[model samples]
Target: MLHVAPSPAVAGNRHRRQMLLPWLDAEGQRRIRESTVLISRVGGLGGPLAQSLAVAGVGRIVLFHEGALLDEDLHRMVLMHPERVGEPRGSQAAETLRRLGGPHLEVHGFDHRITEDEATRWMREADIAVGAAPTYEERLLLNDAALAAGKPFVDAAMYDDETHVLCVDAGKSGCLRCLVPEPPPWRADFPVLAAVSAMVGNLAASLALRILAGAGPIPWGELVHFDAARIELTRVRVPRSAGCPACAAAERTSR
Candidate 1:
């Protein structure tokens, strides 16, 4: 169903040959190359997540985030540069990914926050939607859009030394709204360490690749939590909410 032409340079496949071994075959790699991913935010969690997908040869990536780069952002945002502090974070992240991912990778950077209309349109274009926004409102908006479009949504979050990642398969798994129910009290400035965020981001990226490439079974509807201080990883299944308006709408559309 997905078709992607190889780059003119032989180096494209050659560049990713290391991953083509025991697990991912040539066909699997092609699937990954043809898929498009939508990542919300280029902050700590989303930055490394997008970078991992780009390096793994995901063909197209759409990034949505608002505001200019702050000097404080550099503490955890790996894709940002100190010189581009006043510039838009989304555009800067796109530039960084382009340089790291080479010529064949297509990266679209929106320097503003995504509106409801934009979310609907972009989710339709994305094979998978990743939410790493700092706010629950943005994450829930993305979740609704992804469910409406019947696309898989990956949610990544970090608070202090704790990291959480969840994958939602529309019509098959519990959605973000089901997990959070209502937005909890959250601060704009949350404590996070670079290493902790990157670890969680990479974990989210791995899960996305598995879904896109059909490389392995994905733990859909399960929330994965990692505590850096405790040095432990745990998984718990999340139940679909019967009263979730977003999920209810998605269900109605599917019928």
Candidate 2:
């Protein structure tokens, strides 16, 4: 079970500044404090996403990332400390989030490859799910799990000189597979910069926050892409695929 604060008003005043925003009043803050988020892989993208969610005062964060810290990971993963290079990434990320999130926030870390079974179980409990795994296999699993659980899914990926953010409302909007039916034949290892990944992570976090707080339209079927080299931002409409296997299976089961 995820531990959360009793109320935003009594949560050590960490959210005082954010509470001032019109959309994020006391009620909104309380909503944020009561929500639980699941992030897969606290690496390039998930690291910054988790940080922003923590600062925004999310109630609980369940992180799943299996691996030891690598020298390359240190470049973009802000939560991984320099001294803990040889340690487990998931444990380190959970520890850092707990420290930064303070008494009101609860963080759980699991250092294991997330199987389809595990994804389904955890996504059932998560208010929102984030896909930041290095591989497309994990990303697809997260998307399907979120669809089954009827939760919003946010995914971000970085290429050599560009990054993309996809937000889906499950049944109502197109999902990852809908956007890209199959994983493209890309290199297993890709190039990325800390700044670009952080930017994408922050964007994903913002969308998740809006969904949790009911502050604005959640960008249900939108894809936001940024060109790191040229500094360009573009938005595209993400149409739901009528024949999406994951979604179609759910629709059939519901019927």
Candidate 3:
């Protein structure tokens, strides 16, 4: 329930606190309301994550996906309509995000995978980034972007009924490069299920928003694994890897 501007809306400030009344103070909410985040692949995980962020009053959101909708993807890609089976996914998600956000929400839709150049370009404008892509190549790109930008990046993943989340708050929290020293090969489609997708995606948004609002310290350098089927929820600590490839370049640059 974001309040619309009374009249002239000021730049760098708008109706950002209208929806964050539940857990965020006006100041925290305003910080989020003024920040921007770039989310890759608005598919299964990214769709819900983006929806939650938009609904939570994020000031701006940019999403990228380089594919057309397919029938099989609809089970997880909630923002797409059955009729939009052949339309571009990024375009569809951009429209849906606009509807979910208040008038001040800025939306950028890119129908292409993120490259180093493009990633750096968007990363400069965004405060944080979310990696919901199914492929590790894309995830690696995001990790590099996060490392390059010195910003928070949430690595989200799911397998069957299990979901895992890792937050990377630069300089303070460990990054993806620090946790997984090597990028794992991706399956054509990852082991994602509806239940786990929702859990992981929502958790990603919650964690990202908490960081964005400066509400609490994020679970950086730590991993949270939840499996409802086995009734197992645990946190594992991962130390910074000495030979992480994606981030090694940056570590050397700073020295």
| Candidate 1: residue 178 Cα off by (Å) | 0.7
> Runs in model 3 with CA error above 4 Å?
1-23, 186-188, 245-255
Give one digit per residue, the lDDT tens place, for model 2 in 181-209: 88877765788888888888898888889
Worst 10 residues of 3 by lDDT: 1-10
- lDDT tens digits, residue span 52-114, model 3: 998777888888888889999988888777898988888888888877775767788887787
Highest lDDT scorer: 1
1-255 in candidate 1: lDDT tens per residue? 112223444244543664655667778888888899988898888999999998888888889879989898899999988988888888888888877766677888888998899889988788999998989989999999999888889999999889899999887789889999789975667888889889999999999988888866788999999899999999999999999877886787688
Clash count list over all predictions: 0, 0, 1
TM-scores for candidates 1 onward, in order: 0.93, 0.92, 0.87
Clashing pairs in 1: none
CA RMSD (A), model 2: 2.6
Sort by lDDT, top down from the best:
1, 2, 3
Clashing pairs in 3: 2-18
Model 1, position 238, has a per-residue lDDT of: 94
Each prediction's whole-model lDDT (CA): 0.85, 0.83, 0.77
